[model samples]
Target: MPEKVNGIVADAIRRVRTSSGVPLAFAGVVTGPTTLRLQHFVGQHVGALSGLSVDVGHGLGGKVVALNRLLAVDDYLRTPQITHRYNTLIEREGLRAVMAAPVIVDRSPVAVIYGAMHTPTPIGGRMLDALASEARAVEQEIVAARARMEHAAEGENEMRDRMTAAFARLRDLAGTVDDARIAEELEAITRVLIAGEEPAEEPTVELTGREQDVLSLAALGYPNARIAETLGITVHTVKGYMKDAMRKLGASSRLEAVVTARRSGLLP
Candidate 1:
């Protein structure tokens, strides 16, 4: 289990215990391929379960983990639905009844949270529902955390691909240019681009309504003449708008201006 998940489960245990009025609430995380170790707990007077390892299908928790469902035994020591391997520990702690809820993530059981009573009181439906609700909350937290991590990883991969393409384009331009000074300048820009340094501060640039309309058409591969005809403007006026837009965007070419505008949310 992830360290973040461990903290989440721990907080879930505390929440469940407080909300349900359960005397003892504890949790075991799947620390191995087939075993869950008792990790976090509350209201424990005995240390018999301090380092207990519950294997799949071996105990009540194991059964819950293996079945991927909630399990409760009113008389835990005598329950036939599960094996009694941990009865000694339960007896040591003087627990008469217990319930286990599995925290599943991505269709796999990642942790098991348990609630118990020191007396021979059966866990009621309402209390069981509360425990299951906490487990569901933990499952949602895990799923959301995983989604954020995956989204960040995808963003990083996209940025790397873009940087690689930019570097390749700069290299190609450097090789094709005849002017030595221009080639050296392109080489220097390539080094800066590859270094991935943060720009000082971005200018807060906005495009006018007319400028946006022209750029949107230009992005669709419209020539200046076609844009002028579509917008009921002269070709010279279209060129003037594009030139001003490109200057504000700090783009040397029409394509770069369009890309910058879209990236900066200046154009759709």
Candidate 2:
């Protein structure tokens, strides 16, 4: 997990459990856009559950890992999932009821949050939700998945964590701002950051509206001509803005400008 995002997730999980009546306790992240590479379990008391992997077609989490669905086991050893990753941990914790919910983004499982109680009581369906709900504080894709609309941000759990934490502060800063404007900025920043390039460490400067427009499109991987068509501006004007941005960021390349912007937490 990115340092910034881990801070946010840790803070959020603590706040949610302390403030709410829900018994939800832990979460596990599966990172990647397509092939879900298992990260590790993140829980309230997670020191004991780290031996498992994001192994496909394996344990309970492995099953959720493979199927991208919610799973529950009343008795860890006897349950029909038929495999246990951390049996010693389960026994040590003395938990009887356990539930795992897939946190999806773009119709894929980016992470899973698990809740357990020390008794054999049934975990309510509503309660299973409280676990995953807190995860949304770190990544909107968690809550968004309940609505069942595929969100583009719902990719690797770690990247989503980094992206969300990096942007959440910016979003608050942009409070009450127009959605179109926000969308433009996100579109632009995404392009450069994900382009496998490093933006330079340039001094900060206020960008002109035209410059902002062009950078946003560029960040979203839009070509100069396509950006020109979308913004109803000339390709030459787009090139000019790119030049301005390069100078402002002291960047020699487009990727550098983007990296600097993202590291500064100004763009998504």
Best by lDDT: 1
TM-score of candidate 1 versus the correct structure, residues matched by position: 0.65
Which candidate achieves the best TM-score against the true structure?
Answer: 1
1-268 per-residue lDDT for model 1 (tens digits): 2898899999999998887788889999998778999888887657778779999998899999899999998888887898999999989988888899999987899999989888777789988999999999999998888889899999975775565455545655676799999999987876565345443334379776567667767776789998788777899999999999999889999999877865665543
The worst-scoring run of ten residues by lDDT in candidate 1 lies at 194-203
Report, for every candidate in turn, its global Cα lDDT versus the true structure.
0.82, 0.58
Q: What value of lDDT does candidate 1 attain over all alpha carbons?
A: 0.82
Pairs that collide, model 2: 26-43, 27-42, 32-156, 188-216, 188-219, 191-219, 198-256, 199-256
**Candidate 2: worst-modelled 10 consecutive residues by lDDT:** 33-42
